[model samples]
Structure formats: structure tokens, C-alpha cells
Target: MCKGLATLPATCLKSAKDIKHKISFLLQKPEPQAADQKQMKEKTAAAAAAAAKRVPTAAEVEKWKESFSHVMNSETGRTVFTSFLKSEFSEENIDFWLACEDYKKSTTSKLTTRAKQIYQQYVEADSPNEVNLDAATREETRQNVENACPSCFNEAQKMIYILMEKDSYRRFLNSKLIQDLSQTHSDTAQMKKKKNNCDCTENRQALAGGA
Candidate 1:
């Protein structure tokens, strides 16, 4: 509903669009629509593990909150954050930033192909996932891409990273997904601690009887 946002200088409209996407993503059924309870549980667990990695430890999840770079550094953090960004339909920034990171590490042979794809997807004005960039920056990227090099998208990527660090990254830290993950890990830790205490109590009882 961020209407009339088809052109530049629509910062407010862009923010509205982001807000709309976040709301849409959050408004989901409490359970899978077509599945029975068992199926729902199985599917939910599998999907969560796939999207967020194997039940991220509380320590690991907390580490992500230390910085945007910290979140980007961990595989679990990246996977969860990317999924969140995609749900919000505002993934172009991180996606583009990641594409640039990959492009830089590409073998010489893959450089041109990766560069072309990155430009077509994120640099072109009408690209399916066009990132918000200014006229001067976009034009500069255009020239660099024509030549096809690893550094071609360096400037554009930096801008997108800043955009995300300022906007999306902040929202991500406060999102429900992160909250749920933190709670899940905390619960798991408590359950484990109780089990350990129970075992210790039984061991002490047995040792006292033996003595």
C-alpha cells in the first residue's frame, strides 16, 4: 500500500513499503493450514531448523546482537536474517551486499558471470530486486559492471550495507523471530539444567548409601 512509490525521492514511501512487508510476513496462521497436528509439528520443526540452523545456542544468538557484522559473520545468523529480510520483501540490500561478497571471492573464470548477474538483478533500475541507490551511484556502478570485475560493485555494496545497518539491521534485532529464538534457547538451557541437577542429586544419594 505504499502507493506512488515508483520513482526516486520516495523515502517515506519506501519506509512504508518496508513496514507493510513486515506486517504481511508476521500475519501468518498459528498452525499450518492443511496439516494435522503431528504433521504441523514435524514440518514446523524441520522448517525452523532449515531456516535458522540447529537450534542456535543462547550464547550464539546473543552474540549476533553485538553488531551487524557479528550477525553477518555467523552461518545461523545469516540464514535467519536472510529469511527475515526475504519475508519483509526488502531483501535487495543484504542480498546485493552478499552477492558482492561472493563475487569478490569468485574464481577468475566465474567473475564475469557473477558480475553480470549481480548487475542485472540489483543494479538495473527495473531489475526484479533493484536496490535503492542514488543516480550518481547507480551510474558509476553501470560503468564498472560493463568492464566486469570483482570490484565493480564495491561502492554499491557499501552503500547497501550502510542502508541495511541503519534500517533493516535494527528492525531485525527487535523482530519476533529473534525474540522467539532467544526464548527457545533459554527454555532448552533450563530443561537441560534441571536434568543435570536431577542426575547429580541421584548420584549424591547413591554415594551416601554406599559410604
Candidate 2:
């Protein structure tokens, strides 16, 4: 029989029970098959990661130099540009612009909801993700929020666009992402040159054997 806790503060008994519960929980390990499945998942993920590391080709990287519009147009370019902007803590500009682009497609009935969301998210002074706009532009956007239409965010969007095109776009061209792409281009060119030389040597050896 368990001893009665004569109300002498059964704290020690409670502590002993808590320790027993923790030990039981710790001993309840995952089954062997569960462990094997987790290991399999990790290995599959590593394989996929290896496959996804392919470097962009020189032509693809060069297209970004054509214009700021080109970088925004290419999915890969946008990803790289976004990464650079994130590093600089200025990703909100592109984010707001993209949001406006998507917002433009909202149906007439959905315009008000989408407009208010965009305004609150990226236009208001106290918004969690507010974009940089002049006080006039911010006030103008706030006033425009009531009658929401497809073009509600037009002025604000244009400002952010120009901000990125003029400011961040130039910086991106000189950023480490661009520098890394340039290095990859050079490396690819060198590899092609070496391969061409090897092919020429093989052709010369074949001709000599024929003679």
C-alpha cells in the first residue's frame, strides 16, 4: 500500500511522480521505420538540393543588363534582385510594386477589398510593411482608398517603380549577385575554350594517323 501523505506537504511525492513521468516520456522513442523514413526524406532533400544548384548561363545573366525592366521580367532575375534588396532591407519597394501589379487584376467588386488591403499593408504611415512615398503621395493614396478601382494604387506604384529603377537598380548592377554572375560567365567561357582546344587536338591527331 502507498504511504498516506499525512498532509506533511506531499511535495516530495509529487516531485517523484513528475520525475517518473519525464522518464517515461523520454523512453518513448520513435519506431525504427519512422527513423528510417526520416533519414530517407533527408537524403531525398539533399539530392534535390544538389540538382537545384545549377548556375545560370551567361546569356541568361546578361539579359539582366538590358534594362531594369528586363530584370523585373525574368523570374530568375526577380529572385536574384529580391535577394539583393532583402540584404539591403529595401525589399518592400519591389514587394509593393508586385502587390500593385496583382491588385490591378482584381474584379470590380473585389477592388475595394484589395485596395484597402494594399493601402493598409504598404501605404499607411503606420503600416507594418509601409513603402517609402512622399507625404503628399501617402495622403493622396489614403484619400483614394474609398472608391477603390483598378488604378487606385497607380501613382504610388509608379513612385516605387521609379525608386527601384533609378536607385536600387543601379546598385543591383554593381552588387555581389551581379559580380558572382559575371564570374560564372567568365568560368563558362574558359571551360568552352578548353573544350574547343581539346577537340582541335583530337582532330589533329586523327588527321596525322590518317597520313
Candidate 3:
């Protein structure tokens, strides 16, 4: 009877241990699920990275380069083209043509205004010796010509004009250009030396001038 009783308790203990082990295993199963989730996330991220690495087509780059080359070559043509770009035209090519039209209109207006002013001055002249009206008008005309010349304008406007002429071309220079240009590793020692030299010269000049 004693042996039977002892065997019953031992069997119960073994059953309880087996149940505990099964419960522990069930609890630990979520760990593998978490690992699997992490692995899946890693795989997904890798795939996305690979997709992002896809290079732009060679043909697209070539087309852009060709358009840029065209704009850089022509000055007057580019300028007239860019003015249209700043306007309401959707197509770049059309915008360039529109810019040309606008330029023509502006030029005509300026010429007409200048001519009328000159004619009025000539009619109102008090004497032939009192500054020949024609000579004064000629000088005025020359000055106007200098101001209206393309060389007198800013380079940005010139670039814009080129972009306007060729729809495929675009001038991307801006603050970004400055940032890119400034990214070089500068020599601090050289800069300091230049600054010291400039300061020294300024001080000597100030001393010599009694300032």
C-alpha cells in the first residue's frame, strides 16, 4: 500500500513537470515569431534599398546634356527665349518664341519713345549753336544703345534665356550652386595668412596717412 501511494505522488509530480515544460514552451514560442518578424523587416528593407539603386537611363542624361550644350552656345537667342519662360507658356519651346515676341514689342516701344523725344528736342531748339539738337540726340541714342546691349545684362538672365529657347534645357543654378561650389576643402592656414597680410597692410597705410 505504501509503495502504491509513493508511486502515485511520483507520477503526479512527473505529470506536473511535463505540464510546466509544455507551458514554458508555449510562452517561448512568441520569441521565434518576434525573430521572424525582424528577419522579414530586414528582408523588406533590403529589397527597398535595391529598388532605389536603379540608375537613371543613359538616354535621359544624354538628352539633358545635349540641351544644356545648346543653351550655352547661343547668347541673344538664349536671352529672348528665357523671358518667355518666366511668362505663362507651358511648353518651353513655345515660351522661348513668346519671349522673343515680348522682346520685340519692348524694343519697338523703347525705340519709338526715344525717337519722339529726339524729334521734340529738335523742334524746340532755341539756336543752332545752342547744342545742335541732332548731335545731342545722337549722343543720347548711343547711351541708350549701350544700356540695351545684351552684354550689359546679368548672366542669370542670359542662362534663363537659353533655357527658354530649348524646352529640354533648364538652368538649375541657384543657392544650390553656391553650396556645391563652397563644398571644397579650404586651406585654413592660407586663408589666415591672407587675412593677416591684409590687416598688416591696412594698419601700415593707416599709420602712414596719420589716420
lDDT of each: 0.69, 0.68, 0.35
lDDT of 1 by residue, 1-211 (tens): 2223223234433533453344344333244232222343354345434544254567877898899888877766766676678667786676677668767877888777667777877789998679999999999999997788878898898899888889998999998877766665555555566666767887888899999
Per-residue lDDT of candidate 2, residues 73-103 (tens digit): 7655665676678668787787688778777
lDDT of 2: 0.68
Q: Residue by residue across 1-211, what tens digits does model 3's lDDT show?
A: 1123334444444543443333223222111123423443354334333432322132332333455544334332233223223232333333223222333334544644433332232222452112222444445534544455322212322443444434333443222221222221122233445566767887888898996
Tell me the deviation in Å of residue 181 in model 3: 20
Best of the two (1, 3) by TM-score: 1
TM-score of model 2 relative to the true fold? 0.72
Ranking the candidates on lDDT from highest down gives 1, 2, 3
- What TM-score number comes out for model 1? 0.69
**How large is the C-alpha RMSD of every model relative to the true structure?**
15.8, 22.2, 34.5
In candidate 3, the residue pairs with backbone N, CA or C atoms under 3 Å apart (3 or more residues apart, or in different chains) clash, namely: 78-161, 78-162, 82-161
Residue pairs with backbone atoms closer than 3 Å in model 2 (clashes): none
Ranking by TM-score: 2, 1, 3
Worst 10 residues of 1 by lDDT: 1-10
What's model 3's lDDT at 170? 45
